[model samples]
Target: MTETMDRNFIWDFIEDDLANNPGMKVHTRFPPEPNGYLHIGHCKALCVDFGTARKFGGVCNLRMDDTNPAKEDTEYVDAIMEDIHWLGFNWDDRFFYGSDYFEKDYELAVGLIKKGLAYVCELSAEQFRDPQYCGDLTHPAVSPWRDRPIAESLDLFERMKNGEFPEGKYTLRAKIDLASGNFCMRDPVIYRIKYVEHHRQGTKWCIFPMYDFAHPIQDALENITHSLCSLEYEIHRPLYNWVRDNVDLPGNPVGFPRQIEFARLNITYTVLSKRFLRGLVEGGVVDGWDDPRMPTLCGLRRRGYTASSILDFIGRTGVAKSDSLVDIRQLEACLRDELNATAPRRIAVQKPIKVIVDNYPADKTEYFEVSNNPQDSEAGTRKVAFTRELWIDEDDFAEVPPPKFFRMKPEGEVRLMGAYIVKCNEVIKNTDGSVKEIHCTADLETGNGMPADGRKIKGTIHWLSAAHCEDVTLHLYNNLTTLENPSAKPDDKDYTDFINPESKIVVEHAKVEPPLKDAKVGEQFQFVRTGYFCKDTKYPNTFNRIVTLKDSFK
Candidate 1:
C-alpha cells in the first residue's frame, strides 16, 4: 500500500468513487474457493483486494466461496488462511463462508420465483445446451418450461431442495433475456441440486446456489463496497449487478457493490491453473502440492522465496486491464535480489575431489576468517577450518586444462578462497582412470595474504575441511515445464506432455561447511560460487537450490 506515483486503474476508480460519495468507506473482499492450494496467479487478485483497502484506510474481509462442496475441504481452507497471513495481511474479525448465507440465498431465490423473475427448468444439462435450447447467433434459445406458472415453478424448486429429485433433474434458472448477446444472461442457472455433503454446512442443505448467483448476494449481504475479480469474470458483470439490484438484503445499506475486473497473472514456463496443479499432485507427477518445483505458494516458500520478494514481484508487474505473459526470470530476479542482500554465505561442494596439501603438516589445522555476507557490513565474519586435507569442487580442477581454464591445473597456482595459495604438483588417478586425489604444495607465507612474489592468481576456489564438513543432500531445480507456454501447446497434446523431466536433480552426498549443520529449516544461504539454497522443511539434512548466482533477468 505504499504510495506510488503511478496509480493503477483500480485506484483511480476508487478515488473517483470517494470523490462522488464523501464519507463512504472503501471495503473489499478476497473470496477464494477452497478446492486446491493457491498459486502465484491468485496472489495478484489478493494484493489488489487487500492492498486497496489498506491504501484507503478501510476494511477488507476474507470469505471462502465454498458453495460447491464436491471437492471442498477444511484442509484447503486452513492453507488459504495461512498463505494470506504469510503475506502480512489479515481479515481481523471479518471472515465468512459462502455456505453461511445458504438460508438467505434460498429465501432470495424463492423471492425471485414469486416475482416471476425466475422459474424451475426440467431440462437435463446436456439437453439444455443442445442446439434446440442453446440458440446460435441467428436464433434465440427456446425452453419449453419458460412459460411455466410461478406457483408451479415454486413448488418444483421447493421439491428440488427437499431432495425429492436427483441432481441434474431440475435447475432453477433466472428468467433473463434469451437473446442477450452475453450468454451469461441467457437464463443462467441460479441454483442446482447437489446431493454432495457440504464441508461446513454438512447435510443440512441438498441444493446449493451456483457461484454466479451466490457471489453477488454474499458480497451485498457482507456490505462489500467493491467486488474486484479477475478478467474472466468481466463478461458476468451484468449478472452480478442484476442479483444485487433485485435482492432485498438488510445488510446492503450501501446500495449495490461495484464490480471491477482486472487482468490475471500469467508467467512463461509455469502453469498456474489450480486444476492442472491438482492433477500434478493427484497423478504423482510431483511429490505433493508443496513440491519445490511446483508454482503453489507453499512450494515457493519451500523453495526459499520470501513473502516480501513475492510482493515486490507483484508490485513490479503492476495492475493491468489486459492480460500479458510475464517472463519467469523476473520473479527469480526479485528472489535473487532479496537473498543476495540477506542470505549468509556458506561453502558446499556438490562434487568433491580430495586435495592433499603436501607441504602443510599432516596433523596441522588452521582457521581462516571469512565474511558471512560481504554485502552486509554488520553481518561480521565466521571462522572456517583449513586442514592439510580439504575437499574442493571437482569443477574447479582439470588435469588436462581446457581453453581459458584458470582453475587448478597441473603445475598451476590458484588461491584457496580465504586460505593460502596452492600450486598443483601432481594428479592421482584411481584404478578406473578417474581423479581420486590431487597433490598440491601451499605457500605458507600467503596465509590470509597475497604472495610477496608479485604473482597474480586468476582463479579462486572455495574449499571445506574434509574432516570438519558434513554430508548432505542437495536438490537443484529448473522450469517445471519445458515449453515457454505450456497452456498454448497443440490441442492434440496434453500440457503434462511438456513436463520437464530434468526439473529436479538430486545430489545424494554433498559436503557443506560445519556452520550449515545447525542451519534451521527455512533458513537460506548462498553456496559461495554455486547458488542460493534453503534447508528443506520436510526433509532432514536436505537443501533446495533457490536460484543460481548469475542473474538472467534484465
Candidate 2:
C-alpha cells in the first residue's frame, strides 16, 4: 500500500485512499502563475508535486495558472519551463494553462448563477471591504444585488464578458454565506472586469476569473488527485473545496481533488518572494534574475549549483507542515560533499607572490605528476610544471612571521605541493616598503623521493610555475543581504537597504595551471586548498567560486 512508503501525512492520506479504492493511480499538479522568474522556494513545491507522483508510478501535470494576464508574459513562461527541466523533473505531455479552460470556467460560473448560488454585484472594491458588509460573515450586511433575480445576474455576467460594461463596473461573486465566520466564504468575488489582453488568449474576453475561482476549477478539470500547495493556501482550502463540490467536475479522487498543504522553503540571507526579487533586479541591486548572486534557481545554476546537489539539499530539508528557515550552509554543504568527490584537482594562486628557486637551474622546467582527484582514483592524474620561478599566494609568506606561521617566512621551510620542499633564504623588498619577492632554494634530495632521514614537512602550499601559469578571473560571492530575514524587516525599511555592499568581488589577476585555460563553460574544478569553482557561463577564462573548502555555514 502507498501508506507504507513514507510517513508524511500527505502520502499517508493517499495511501489510505488507494487501499480502499484499489487500482486508482495518484495524480498531482504544479500550477505556477507565470508572472516572474522562479526562485528556490518553488523547488520545494516541485519536489512534492512531481516526487509524490513519481513515487507512486503516477503522473503530475505542469499547469500554468495564468488567469491574471495583466502581468503575465511568454518570457516568464519559457524561463519557468527551463528552470523546472534543469531541476531534473519532466512533465512530459501533461501540460496545461488556466486560460486554456477559461471558456469551461465561464460555463461553470453560469451554471452556478442559474442555480442561484452566485450573483453580479455593483459594490466598488472598497465597499466589499467595509465593516458593515464584510468580515463578520456571521452577521454581515448582504449586498443589495444578492437578492436580485437569477435572470438579471446571468444577463449582467454575459454583458460583463462581452465588454459592454467598463472595468470595475461590476463583479460576479459567489453567494456562499452572509454569516459565515471564514472571510473567504463571505461572498468572495468569483470574476472581475479586466479590460486587458491575455498573453495566450488575446482580446477574446473582457472579464477574467480571479485566482481563487480559477484554481480549483483548473484542478478539477485536470482531475488532479491531490491539489498540493504551500501552507499559505491552507485557509483557501475551504474555497478550493467549495468550487470542487459546488460545480460539477468530472472524474474522481474519491469525489473531488483533495487539497493538501505543506510548508514552503525559506533560507537565511535570501528572499524568495518574486515581488521582492523583482525589486532587486529592477533596482539594479543585483544584475538580473540569473545574476550569480541572486537566489533564483537560474542564479544558483549560473553560480554552478548542480541539480543533484539541490535535490540533496531539499532531501535534507524533509517535508513538514510547519514552516522553518534553513541555513544556507546546508545547501552549500551539499555542493561541497558532491564536488569534493567529483571535481578534478588543480593548482591556482589568486594573490600571487613571486618566488625564485635560486639554487635550482634558472632555465629548468620539469613535469611533476599529481592526482586529478584523490577521492576518485579513476579520475586519473595530471602533470603540473615545476620550474625555477613560481607564483605562490602572497599571504603564504610573511616578512615578519606570527607564532606558528609555518607556510613561509625568512629562512622558513615549506613544501611546494607535488614538487620539492623549499627553504626561503632571502626577502627582497620593493621601494614602496612591500615584499617584492622571496628567494628560495629547493632541497635537491626532496624532489619526487623520500629523504634519507625521512624528515616530515609540517606545511604544504600550492604553487604555479610562472612559465606555465595562465591568468584567469575569479568571481567570489557573499550573501546578498546583511540580515537573515530581510523580507521580515520593519515595514518602513526597504529590503534593498539590507543589501550587502560586498556581495560580489572579482579577482582579475588570479593564476592557474595552463590546462585550466581550456576548461569549457560549466566544468567544475577544485582549486587544491582554495575552493570548488566552475567555469563561468558568460565570461571566458573566468571561474565562479561555488563554495569554499571550509564549511562555516552555521
Candidate 3:
C-alpha cells in the first residue's frame, strides 16, 4: 500500500461517505479519451484517481473514453496504458473501452425517448446555437421538435442509428428544461450523428453518444463509487445526476456513482491543451509528441524524469478546489533534489579546451578515486584516469582575468577536482587568436589535498583525461515558451508565437570520462558541476541534460 501524509477536501468527503454508508468500497475509475498523448497536467488526475483508490484499499479501473472517434486512435490507447504503467499504477483485469457500451447507450437513449425524457431534434448544430433557438438568460430556448411524438422520435432515432439520415441532419437531445439557469441543462444534445468510422467499433456505430450521456452510464454499469474528474465538469454534475436518476440500469450493487470535481493542474510557460500540442506535431514545430521540449509524459520520460520524482511533486502540490498556475521551477526542484542524492557523478567537458600538465611525467598515468555520489555514502567511489593531457570546459578558463576570477587563468592556481592543485603558467593560442591550450604545472604533492604552503584555492573545476575520454552529443532543454502564461496571450497573438527559439541546444562532440562509455540508455548521472543528464533513449552516444543543479523555486 502507498503511504501518504497528504490530505485534501476530497478525502474528507470520501471519509464521510464511508462513515455514512457502512461497507462502502471506495471504487474509482480513470477514464481518458484516446485522442492525444497524456501530459503532465493529466498526472494530477492520474494520481488522484489511482492514488485515492490505493489509499482506501479499493480498486481503480482503467477505461479508454473512446466515445468520440473522430480524433481517437489505437496508438493513443496503447500509449495511455504504457504511461500509466510507467507511473507505477495498474488496473489489472478491469480494463474497458467506452465503445464497449455503445449498444447499451443506444438502448438507454431509446428508453429515454419512450419515457418522454428525450426526443429526436431536427435542428442542425449551427442552427441550434442561433440566438433564436439558444435563448439568453431572460428567454427560454425554443425547439420545434421538442413536442414530437415518442413513436416517431424512436423510429427516427433508430433510422438515424441505421444511417438513414445524413450527418448533422438529426440529433438525440435530452428533454431537459430549456429555461433552466444552467446552460448545459437546456436540452443538451446527448447523441449526434457522425459518419466517421470508430477506431474500435468500426462502422457498427454511426450515431454516437456524447460524453455527458455515455460517461455516467458507464460509471453506473461499472459500479463506480466515485467519479473523480476535473473542476471543468462541476457544472455538468446536475446533468450527470439527471441521467442516473432517469436511467433504469442493470444490477449495480453500488447504486449510482457520485461525481466529484477538483482543480486541474496548470503550469506557467506550459500549454496542456492536446489540440495545441497536436498542431505543433502536425506543423513540424516539434520532432514529435515525445520531443524532450514537449510537456507530454512520454516526452518527460525520454528527457529523464523519474516516476518517483513526479509523484513526489504531485503529492507536494496537494489538491485544491480553485485553479492556480504553478511555477515550473517547483517541478524542476523536485527532480534536482532527487537526482542530487541518487545519481552517480561523472565528468563531462562541454566546449572542451585542451590542458597539458607541463610538470607531470608525460609517459605515466595515475588513477584518482572520486565519490560516485557525495550525498550517498554507500554509493562508494570510482577511479578516474589522470593523464598528462586533460580536457576541461572552455568556460573554466578566462584569457583575460575578470574581476575576482577564481578558475583557470594565467599564473593563477585552481584545484582540478579529485586530482591535484594546478597553476596555469602559459596559454597556447591558435592562428585565430583563440586559446588553443592551457599549460599548467600540477603540485603533485597536493593530490586531492590542500597545498603544503596553506594557499587557498578558491575554485575547483572538473576535467577528464583527454586520452581516456569519449566524445558524446549533449542536448540541453529549456522552457518551451518564453511567456509565463502562453494561454493568456493577447487576442491577436497566437500561443505558438511565444515558442522559445533556444528551447533546445545541441552540443556535438562533448568529452566524457571513459566510465560513461558503457552507460546504458535511460541511465541518469550527475555530470559533475555541469548538470544531471540521462542517456538518450532514441539516439546513440547522446545525453540529455535533465536539469541544472541550481534551485530557482522558493
Candidate 4:
C-alpha cells in the first residue's frame, strides 16, 4: 500500500478505481479546521485534493471542519479563503462548513439513540485522565452506566439538549465495541456536551458531535468521494468509516468516502504546529502570526513569497506515503528560482556609509541606466540617481582590506553599480572612532553603468545617492524555534521554552532608493545583494526578509 509512486503505479491506481465502479463519480475535498492560519504542510494536502480531482475530471470541495468552537474564528476562515485563492484554486460555489449540518446531525444522533446503538454516558474528565481508562488488548473496562435503560438514556439525552445538564454530565457514545482489538472501536464518544457558542452556528448547538464521529458523515452528506488528509489521520480511517456505516445518511448509501493518507510535509528547523506557533507569537518570541520570520502563510506572504512558487514547491514535493523532513533550503530554492525570473531587481543599502566624490561637482545629480531585471529581457532598464555624495554598504569598503580584496579599499577601484569607478582617497573617522565617511574621486567619463569598451574593474559595488536616499525599515528573519525538532522533545520542558527570542530583528535605520518609498504594504522587492523582502503588514514602512539571495544558507 506504501509503494513508491511511478507513472505505472499512478496509472494502475486510477485504472483500478475506474474498473472497480465504472460509473462512480470522483469527488475530493480539502477540509481544514478554522482554528489557525494554514502552514506550508497544509499546502501538500491542498495540492493533492484539488490537483487530483482536476486531473481526473472531478469536482473538489473546500470544506471547513468547524467542530471545536473555542479555538475556531471567523478571521481564520477569511484567511483560509484568501490563501486558497492566492494558491490559484477556485472552489466555485462548493465551499461547505461542517456546522452547516447542525439540524441533520442532531437527527442522526437521535436515530442512533432510538436504535440503542448509542448511549449517553456520564463519565467525568477525571476518569479519562487515568492511563488505564482505555484497557489493553485482552481486557476492556465497561463504564458503570453503559447498561442504563434506553428510556432513561433518551430522557437524559433530551434533558442534556434542553440545557439541564452541565457541560460534562452526559456524552453520547457509540456501542460499537467494548472489547474490540481497536482502541477507537471501544465505544468511542460520538457526541460531547459542549456548551460554548460556535463561531458559525452561534449558540444553536450545545450538544455537538465529536470530530471523529461527525467528519465521515459530513463527507458522505456532501457526496465527497475521496477524503484526502495527512498521514496523522491514518488510524482515524477505521473510525471514520464505522461512523458512516452505523449512521443513516441523506439520499443514497454512497456516503462511504474513501480515506487516503499521504506523507505530511516536514521542513527542517521549522515548527509547523499551530499551538507551538501560537506559543512563539504569544510569548513574544516572534513579532506576530504574520511576522516574516514565522512560517505561517501570512508570514510567508509578508516575507515576499509568491503563491505560484508555493504551488510549484508542493508539486515538486510529489505524492508519497513515506514520512520525511524537507530541507528548508529546498523550499528556499523554489522561491529563488521563481523570484529570479519574476521579481524586478533594485539596489538598496543596509548600513550605509557616506562616499564623497571629491573629483565630481558637489551639486551635480544624475541617473545611471541600469537593468531592471537582468534575467528578464522585457523588464528593460531603469535610472538610478548618482550624486556627488553617494551611500554604499559599510562592508563594501575596507580601510585596510586584504591584499587580494577586489572591492572598495584604499587605492582599489570598484564600479559603483550603476555609477562610476571610484578610488578611495581618504577615510574619515568619527568621534567614536567609527569610519564616518570615505572620500573618493569618480572618473566622470567612465561613470556609466558598465565599463567603457574593453576597460574593466575588479568588482562592482551597489550604491544609492546619500542626498536622495529614503529611510526604510528592515526586518531580518530567523527560524521560529531553536530546537530542530520540537515534536520529538520530552514532555517536561515546554517546547515554547525553547523558542528563540531573536527570531526577528527590526532594523529601523536601513536606507533605500527613492523609488521604493511608494512600495505598498506586503509588497515584495529584491534588495540587490541582500535578498527578497516584502512590505511588513504590521509595519508598512519596512520590509521583511523571507529568504536570502541563495537557497542554501551554507
Candidate 2 Cα misplacement greater than 4 A, ranges: 1-6, 136-142, 449-455, 552-554
The lDDT per prediction is 0.91, 0.87, 0.91, 0.80
Error of 1 at 318 (Å): 0.2
Per-candidate TM-scores read 0.98, 0.95, 0.97, 0.92
User: Which of the two, 2 or 4, has more TM-score?
Assistant: 2
Across residues 1-554, which tens digit of lDDT does each residue of candidate 1 receive?
44321479998999988888788899999999999998998988889999999898989999999999999999999999999999888999999999999999999999999999999998899988798898977788878999999999999999988899999999999999999888899999999999898999889899999999999999988888889999999999999988888877765545459999999999999988788899999999999999999989999999999989998889989999998999999999999999999999999999999999999988878888999999999999999999889999999999888998999999999999999999999999999999999999999999878889888999999999998999999999999998797558898887788999999999988999977878999999999999999999999999999999987579
Superposed on all Cα atoms, the candidates' RMSDs to the truth, in angstroms, are 1.4, 2.3, 1.5, 3.2
Ranking by TM-score: 1, 3, 2, 4
Instruction: Give the better candidate number (2 or 4) by lDDT.
Output: 2
**Between 2 and 3, whose TM-score is larger?**
3
Error of 4 at 153 (Å): 2.0
Let me know the TM-score candidate 2 reaches against the reference structure.
Answer: 0.95
Worst 10 residues of 4 by lDDT: 1-10
Question: Candidate 3 lDDT (Cα, whole model)?
Answer: 0.91
